[model samples]
Target: MLTDTLRKVDNLMKNKFTAILVALCFCITSVNFTGLLTVSAATYGDYTYKVSNGEVTITGFDDSVSGAITIPAEINGYPVTAIDKDAFYGCDSLESIEIPNSVKIIGEGAFRYCYALTSVTISNGVTTIGEEAFEECSSLENIQIPDSVTSIGQWAFYNTAYYDDETNWADGVLYIGNHLIKADRD
Candidate 1:
């Protein structure tokens, strides 16, 4: 009878140990996945950036930043080559932005939903503006795309006063390098 009781107690302890090991593994996996999501991001000054291949990409702006923002040409001696996806998403108080000449790419949704953004000055070195880069910027009136730009992605400026169908701009048209980009009237 004693041997039978000992065997039962041993089996219960083994089962509990196995359950604990499985739970521990699950917890570790969850933490690792969460770390992967935010691992590349690091804050510098008012921006969160990621550095890869000797270049820096501005990943996001600090929520406290307002009004104007001027991205530096370099961060920690690495050229700021790109503005990463959703870099300035939903920054409603941002009014204007000056992207320096060293930047080469503007990632998808980089400036989307910045309702108060009015003017954007993309300097001469940028080559690509990613999809929906400036979408939903209701107040943005003017943007001068430099000749160096080779690709402007789909809906890059959608829902802005410059591209929306409802509002008629003073010129009643929007032109991109002598090509008709958008027009409200004939």
Candidate 2:
């Protein structure tokens, strides 16, 4: 009878040990998977302002920023294709900007309300400037829209100050390679 009892006890202990080991392993696996999910959420959640050729598209600007900003020529190794509407709106201290040739389009209000912007150099590959692209850029003293662009949207420079003096402008008529855009409104 004693031997029989001993055998039963051993069997029970073996089963209990196996159950504990499995439970510990399951707990560890759960913790590992949870940690991985947390890392992934954090990485994808933070603010990443950019637009790329295939992966991401920038739509607009959400906050005000000061100082000059040099938008990266590429994002995630893909060339930047578009500048969305209001992309640099309310950036009061933005003094100058260089739009790279890789950018094909500039959306509406892209530089609106940039009060301190004094110069802009649009590269030769851009094709379109959307409506009100530079609206209210009061301090924008000089702008050179390249010859490659074919379309300038309505009111692109509405409510903004432009070259009142010869030194502030290259010509009385804003010319994109002999295609006159406008005459300074008296």
Candidate 3:
């Protein structure tokens, strides 16, 4: 009877030990995978924020130079696709901007407060212009909105030379169709 009882105890211990090992393995796998996912999320979209041309790359601001800045059209054989929010914000000396046809989206506040910005040329294929995209550009004079654009968010060009003068839409004309949205002088 004693021998039988000992065998039962041994079997019970073996089963419990196997269950514990399985649980530990599951916990380790869960923790390892969670860590890997967190790292991926942090680095997923980090590459789309800067402008690079292999020969010359520009990002954020140009504290060394005080005058005009020209972002490259291509970077490392890849066409420039995105200009991050505030990429050129507060560039007071920026007199003009030329966005290439390769660009698809201009993030919020991308060109905010370019006090000296007078000319802007947006190339084809751009579909969306984010809010405050060109806000507070007081000196901006000529703006060409491509027909490919479908939506213009609120305050996208607010407090700028385009909308500052309510009486004169001549200074700024939103080009949508083959026609322009202008004031009727009738």
Q: Candidate 3's error at 25, in angstroms? A: 14
TM-score of 2: 0.62
Error of 2 at 6 (Å): 71
Q: Quote the lDDT for 45 in model 1.
A: 94
Backbone N/Cα/C clashes per model: 0, 0, 1
Query: Deviation in angstroms for 169 in model 1?
Result: 8.4
lDDT of 2 by residue, 1-186 (tens): 999999999999999999999999999876744422321111112223443224233454434555555554665555666777887778777888888888788889888888888888888788998888888888876778888889988778665566344443454555445445566544
Compared with the true structure, the alpha-carbon lDDT of candidate 3 equals: 0.65
lDDT of 3 by residue, 67-173 (tens): 55455566555466666688778878888888887777777888888888887788887777778888899977677888887766656766667566555455455
Q: Which 10 residues in a row give candidate 3 its minimum summed lDDT?
A: 38-47
Full-model lDDT for every candidate: 0.84, 0.68, 0.65
Q: Rank the candidates by lDDT, best first.
A: 1, 2, 3
TM-score of each: 0.70, 0.62, 0.60
Candidate 2 clashing pairs, residues 3+ apart or interchain: none
Q: What tens digits encode model 1's per-residue C-alpha lDDT throughout 111-176?
A: 999999999999999999999999999999878789889888877888887776444444776565
Question: Candidate 1: where is the Cα deviation over 4 Å?
Answer: 1-40, 165-174, 178-186
